[model samples]
Target: MTTIQVGLYFLLGAYILFSIFFCTLVLFSTFADSVFIRYLSSTHLGKPVVYHLQQVVEWLEGPKCGICLAQYWSTGDMAPRVMNCGHTYCGSCIEIFAEQKDGMVICPFCTRTHFCNTIHPLPFFSENHLLIILCSSLITVNLWKCQTCRKKYSSQDVSRTPRVYSTCGHTSCEACVESDFTQKKRVVCLTCEGRSGGITVVAENWKPHVPINYAIRDLLKE
Candidate 1:
């Protein structure tokens, strides 16, 4: 073929491939939305429960906060909380909303009312440790593998602790590290076969433990 003809054929083929990719993306999005709607319809729960389940499913599929319209955060204030109606929201937003409502707060999505006592600061859905562990563990099971043990980390593990990620982006179960540290004074990286530089002893007589990388935890959950 002539040089110009060959170049033209290449460009045409590239355009066809790009068009196919764009169409596939659109089709996948539409299919996903339809599936979600069908799943919601199948659930016969109350509006509040349905709304919360939708949020949970959406969050599981892709991470984002329904309240603040921001991505999920694992920090103390920004952590995700579940409501009495079984919905989830960011802890910071729920606190502010509760205060504004004078301890009688209603859910915007499902219109469910929840009472808050800021004086005693009773635990909200966010404070439910078991729920937090299960949700976070479900996410962790999908994304992380314990480098040291080569096993998928689950919240249902003996300690039910959140998965710990090192500064090097390697993940390990809390049990494995604690066990190793209890037996040996130094924390070793299972992936690299060396001491992780980020871990340190904070106090005398206290066994050193690796810090939980909340960002990675949040990402996995999301």
Candidate 2:
């Protein structure tokens, strides 16, 4: 081969090798621990954060509170509470919903009645501890943003808005429900385009009249 042709061939081979090396470095950096740490640090939750693949799945597919139509907090006063019919709701919202039902609480989703009478005459609700841990893990990484509006679920504001999921496992906020109801006369799922029949006012005194998706929440816990 001519000298110039040989030189061109060598340059092309070097360029291909350099391109491969650059692509490999990019892929490595994408999954590097430092990159994970940068995301963790940006959340401002704390130090020594550990990443888990299962937690990521839970955070992406976790259930939202049917009442108030916001994501479940799963900690402190906002911890999730289960009804006799297997529906779940934010602890505080459930209390407000059941406050006027004597000692009986009704499942808004299934319409099944459950008794929450404390043997010592104290008030209480059934809590899902595993779900709470999953939620807390998501919060630590700041992945609590609602998939619908892309708005972050604020842990500092414990009383922030509520969330509800459709039968198709899609979530929507109380404000969206209200807006759509006023315009369409029914609550619509922004994700699946499913319609919630007969839901006139979902957010009444910060409580939604819809039922929670306990099944999805349980699955995440598992």
Candidate 3:
């Protein structure tokens, strides 16, 4: 065969290989995304609970706050809070809304007004425990893996505390972080390095301590 013919054949073979790899990557990504979406939907619809309980939970937690349009967190000020009208909003937004209207919090969706004393009196709203549980479950399902060791976080294993690096924001179990630091004498983000083709230096905050990821820890507790 001519050299030109051989070169053309090689080019065709390379293109075929690239196309297969690209298609496989796309398929895998789609599958992962679909799984995540289905889990999210199940949480929203309260599929794991009894029919009656599901209805009640769904009514209490409607995914996001209408005022701020942000998804509820498991804890802290951004956590879901329920008013007297049974409508839920993030704790921060609800407090702001209540204060804006002179201690009368109006539900933006239903236009129902709830009065808060704002002084030494009955609290206007309460934390939505059911919604907090749901949010924590979602977070646990999605982010339970330790980036370094690739081990899953379990409530049974109270020893494993996930720690987030200050610079890279990647999380790994406390054991892995300590081991890595001991071996290398410095903390670096392996995941970031693998992806970006260079060493990504995490802040030297490991000298004194690496802060535990309270958000992940809180979810794992549930």
Candidate 4:
């Protein structure tokens, strides 16, 4: 084979060889040292950062679990199961999913294949959950549920889907934020209204009767 082809083969062989070592013998050399749990959130291969929660802001942007609707948006030591399909879910949600699929564990989000690595909680799982949830409220750019109307809206929703952001960093999703600019009796921001024409109001200004679009939060997580 050509030199380049031979080098490529050698690299591939080395990677597979090392993967085997990590999976089987080298890591097990000492039970105390066999920190398999540490690697649980680490990507096995090319899995997206979304599959593994590490970065703070990135985690908030990860997709919501399709099954439970619980926000898995924070990256602070959250425990999860990554299926063979590259889909991830919290342990509780995964258990329910597995049971529904005859113990086969199909991905509720994709058709990549099905299998699970369950019970692999990180050492800091519990602590991280609390931290992230608490941070969710304090983060400046995060969404707030209108206490008056109980409608939740993010900063982005106030402006719109952000079709194209302006030089100053403001975005315009005309489809969603058009009414806010119109002279209609009432205008609603995309983040807080279901029907239309509800004025975009801050948490304090929002009506207690309106509702937040929970779905958009999920999308933002993704």
Best by lDDT: 3
lDDT of 3 at 220: 57
- At residue 26, what lDDT does model 3 achieve? 52
The residue ranges of model 1 lying beyond 4 angstroms of the native Cα positions read: 1-61, 64-143, 160-162, 165-169, 192-209, 213-222
Worst 10 residues of 1 by lDDT: 201-210
Where does model 4 exceed 4 Å of error? Answer: 1-64, 73-81, 117-222
Ranked by TM-score from best down, the candidates are 1, 3, 2, 4
Estimate, for each residue in 25-109, the C-alpha lDDT of model 1 and write its tens digit. Answer: 5554456457655675567764454555555455454444566876445557656555544355667777777788777667776
lDDT per residue as tens, model 4, 1-222: 999999999999999997985554333333322344345435566234323323333433443545675656455323333332223466566565555665555655665445443443222112222223433555422353333343444435544332211111112244334444344434343343423222233443222212222223333431
Q: In candidate 3, which residue pairs clash? A: none
TM-score of every prediction relative to native? 0.36, 0.35, 0.35, 0.24
Ranking by lDDT: 3, 1, 2, 4
lDDT of 2 by residue, 1-222 (tens): 999999999999999998986674554445545776567655746343333433443355455676776667756666676543446678667666556676666777777776765332123444543346556564432344444666544424332233443233333444554565567655555555654321233443323343343433234221
Better of 2 and 4 by lDDT: 2
Between candidates 1 and 2, the one scoring higher on lDDT is 1
